[model samples]
Target: MVRKIFRVLLTILGVVTGFFVADSIINSNYIMNLGYFNNMVAKVSLYVFATLSFGIILFLLSPIFYKGVSKLTDAVEKSIGRLSASEIIFGAIGGIIALLIAALFILPINKLLPPKLEILGTVLSIIINTVAVVVGVDISVKRKDDIMALFEGWKKGSSKDKKGKVKGVAKVLDTSVIIDGRIFDICQTGFIEGPLVIPSFVLDELRHISDSSDGLKRNRGRRGLDILNKIQKELTIEVQIWEGDFPQIAEVDSKLLKLAQKLNGKVITNDYNLNKVAEFQGVSVLNINELSNAIKPVVLPGEDMNLTVVKDGKESGQGVAYLDDGTMIVVEGGRKFIGENINVTVTSVLQTAAGRMIFAKQKEV
Candidate 1:
């Protein structure tokens, strides 16, 4: 029924177009001089024939038009679906502003053109409007972060009267830190402040890892996702999943640095390589490994400590033990007591970017 109605409407539009065409041709200076279209009957006959012919043609082509319209609607819907609400709002505002600016120039410009160049004026006006709208949307998209930040700052100002006000910094999370799972514990301790910003690309990488063929990678990936869920549910701080991404950047770490710079946020990760890269790029990084090292119990030389000799170290008589926090202790001349718990005196402590290592000699039996 809808198709039939649409076909009828199309036929009517075609008939109206045909009538206008016939009238224009018949009234033309050349046609008037020929004197054949002067008679009322002849003109009426011609108009009726043109209208009927166009109506029939359009009715026949209605199915093709329906298919074209359907495809167009689907394409538009898909494009709109990919745009975020903010993008759409900005785009609409941009388009309106462009049109208004175009209108301001179009009237005077059109009047200044020669009558023969009237079509040129119309074309130029259309081009100007198109260019303006494209430029506006591009600018809006590129400056979206700045615009959002301005709005957010204003909002925060309005709510300054509220008690227990905490200023939140944007803390962007990296894939490695999520997989390390220490972030969850750190958040639970209430030491870290700010809105935990998880990039969409990081989440995508995690998903890929979780679906990997290698069992170890798959487990790590899944654990990261689980940790993210725990943080979102248990932590009092805001956990935001940021949808913004930089397509120009190929590597996740590079993209993360770009995102941090854009948000004016710090990158949180346990990745040594990423930490160094961020430092070189002048981006702030909150390294989980560094944090862990800082909080580990301080060991001084001549301090007595007890540890189980779990394995032999690289040295011929060095037995390896670990502190509760996983700090390695190298016990001298204790290789014979690999399976036994022994008291050791801390001889020295070495700290590196990786972690802290304690060098000690076994206490006398």
Candidate 2:
């Protein structure tokens, strides 16, 4: 139904264009003095012929035009999908201002050109309008933060709090942190303040994962989605799904880093590689693994603790055990005691960027 209506509109536009063309030709005097017939009959015949021919051509080409229109719409939708609401609003405002400013000179410029060059003047006006709109939108999008800050400052009279500290910063969640699912607990504890921003690209990645063919990946993806729903519904803090994205950056981690820089926010993740990359880029990161290690019960050297040896370690005669918090402990000479609970003395503790590891020797009676 819509396609039929669109085709009819296109045919009407074609007929209107043909009428204008016929009028221009008739007024030019070249085709009117053909001496073929009376002026009135010639003019009427030309108008009818042009209108029918153009309308039929457009009606036949409607499908092709429709395809082009569909492609253009998809392209526009995809481009706009990457932008946040604020960006679109500011971009529209900027474009309107640009067009208004261009209107001031459009008439004067058209009048200055020779009558023969009227088409050139019209084309120039179109070019100027197009350039102005493009420049306006680009400028607005690039300086959105400054624009927003101006409005915010105007509204509040000041953005700083009574303590002189800047207001809250968004906590950007990455893919790994979402899947790890400890963030829910952290948010529940109220340690993480401010709005938690889940980037749209991150959500896309999660959806892809959830739909993965592999069972493990699919489960992880679903779990992440569940965790996100839980955070948004169960937690008091705001969980926003940010639509801002960087098309140039292919990697999710790179995109997250760029977003952090843009928003002046921190990236929260449990991925060690991402943590290092973010640190190198001078973007603050909150690593769940690091946080877990920090809050684990501190064990000092010579401290005695009971651990159940569940498996053998890589080294000969070594047994591996785990603390309640998942910290690994390597027990020396305890390989024979697999599946047995034994007392061990903490020999030393090793802390790395990854996590903490403890070496222990079996305590002797």
Task: Specify the highest-TM-score model's number.
Answer: 1
Off by over 4 Å in 1: 1-19, 39-82, 101-121, 161-163, 213-215
TM-score against native, each model: 0.81, 0.77
Query: What are the RMSDs of all candidates, in order?
Result: 3.9, 4.3
**lDDT agreement with native, every candidate:** 0.89, 0.89
Stretches of candidate 2 off by over 4 Å are: 1-87, 104-125, 149-166, 307-312, 336-342
Predicted candidate 1 versus true structure: per-residue lDDT over 36-153, tens digit per residue? 8989999998899889988889989989998899899999999777666777887788778778888889889998999999899989998999998888887776787788779988
- Write the residue-wise lDDT of candidate 2 on 242-361 in tens digits: 766788889999999999998889999999899989989999999898888899999999999999999999999999999988899999987999999999999999998778999999
